[model samples]
Target chain A: MKLRKSEDSENEVELNMTPMIDVVFLLIIFFMVVSELSTLNLEEIELPLADESEVLKSEKLDARHIICNVREDGTIRIQGNSYKKEQLADYLKVEADAEEREPANPSNPAVPPSKLYLTIRAHKDTKFENVQNVFDACSQNGIYKTRVMATKDE
Target chain B: MIARLLRRRPRSRSSRPKAVEEAKLELTPMIDCVFLLLIFFMCNLEFVKQDGLIKAFLPKDRGQSTGPSVTDLGEVRVKLLWCAPGTTIETEDRDVGEVVLKIEKNVYPRSGATPDWEMLYLDLVKMRDIRDRSGNPDALPVIIDARPLVPHAAVVGALNACVKARIKDVTFAAPERPF
Candidate 1:
């Protein structure tokens, strides 16, 4: 049998692109806005107010600094990523290793604990044992410079 | 002459089609990819952490006792006590069943037997002033002795009270009884 000529070949199809470009621009804007909203890598928890809490400034918002979050349900999250409680120390170790290297001072050599800073963001309602476990993990992994985050009381 | 113009019209339409096609950037595929990316981001977005950092020392490792002497109560020893769920009486000031804070044997809200952070802050301020009046150049360290079962909020509440009083030297004491 002879092949039949295509029926739609007589008409030239032109695809409209304005809507596509408009949608793409919108998507790019949406992603950019949401990404900026997530600068801190943790979940929002009701923090206990300390009338005397000091406002601390993080050195760099990058990987050199790490955040460990303990939710009210005792779930542990590291840098917005979930981790089993048993694996907390290993995660901190990996993050510490990934930290940027610093030049060792000749007079006062920096120790492993001094290299990276660890921050614990525990929920106000979370059990003290949960926070202590994470703190123990920090101690075990040689993470000495640790900060417990809280909100200033009104 | 008429035949020549007609021939040029067909040629122009065919040849100029390439320019028209090039002007239309075929952004549908790119838009599709962006939509996929947007969906990925939306599905993965988690809650943002809004709490601020309060510089606190980690607990002393097990069996390592480098803490100050027990006689240094004047140095601001804020003890946090956790009550059983049913034993805690509901107070107008604090939520029911919250941990209590004690400074120098004086419990917050001496009358209600509930957590009163404001009163705790005043005491810490006095302790800080006493330390400063003693002519100590170094910042005075405040010991936070919290029970293992106490909620972190109570510990943080005590710490915040100290920090709000400008007592920055904060340290956590090992739980008297391990969990």
Candidate 2:
């Protein structure tokens, strides 16, 4: 009986989680690092606001006009003219160049002409894809400054 | 030594048998893997939650545009009106007009006389010029009014034009749709 009891005690099973925990922690760290890296290359998207404050009196907003109009027939116009959907990149490049040339003021002396402001006017029925396209164009052309125009209800 | 000597009574010809048991999986390792996977997915997931994609008009300090004097300060109010296939655009202020371009029935051809593309590009360039001349390019706010039937592609084209023209501020005017 004593020998049998000793044998039974030797056969008892138990699990060790130390190595498993170590592997899990390592994996967690790996994922954390990867997620951080992935976000670095992600695009910065500005969500459209409903209750945005009015244009400030600061002098930074003193140059360049960007008017976007979305029509019912699926026609898009900047100012009065419509642009081909594909030529957005080229157009932005040209606009950015023009903005760089026109100095905001010759008398200010402190403000460089390189600053250009952008105004995006999207219609109520406009698709999100259209807005994204505009953003993409601006990013490609190095025009980071932007604003949204809204109308007040009576 | 005395115990061994006492136990050594009979010498039988028999070899010691080998002990064997079935292999078993470690539940702890699998549980740990499940937890790790859960954490990975939770961290990597990007949830995109946005209120409706309508343009919001920010408050202008000057209040609302009421009369001619307000309009003369080089405040260019560019209005976009949305319409159906054959509907004409109407505006609250008659002076603020709508530019209509018909959508061609044929597929937008890649080559032969891309009139639509040319028109859109020209309009954007012209607006840019006006905004630059206004001296306050950043404040040149453009408002867009669109109907329900308008295709989303058209709106995108408009946005692209604004970006191309270096116009940063844009707002959409939406009135509650009556059911």
Best by DockQ: 1
Query: How displaced is residue A86 in candidate 2, in Å?
Result: 39
- Using lDDT, give the best candidate's number: 1
Best by TM-score: 1
C-alpha positional error of residue A41 in candidate 1 after TM-score superposition, expressed in Å: 2.2
Model 1 CA lDDT for position A69: 79
What docking class should model 2 receive?
incorrect
The fnat scores of all predictions, in order, read 0.61, 0.08
lDDT of 2 at A110: 36
B51, model 2: CA deviation in Å?
A: 15
Model 2 lDDT per residue over A44-150, tens place: 22222333224445435557656555443335556456765567667766777876643434333333333455556555344444654565455445554555543
Q: List the residue pairs that clash in candidate 1.
A: A50-B160, A51-B160, A51-B164, A52-B160, A52-B163, A52-B164, A53-B164
lDDT of 1 at B76: 66
Tens-digit lDDT string for candidate 1 (A77-135)? 87567787678878876766666544443422432343577888888888787888787
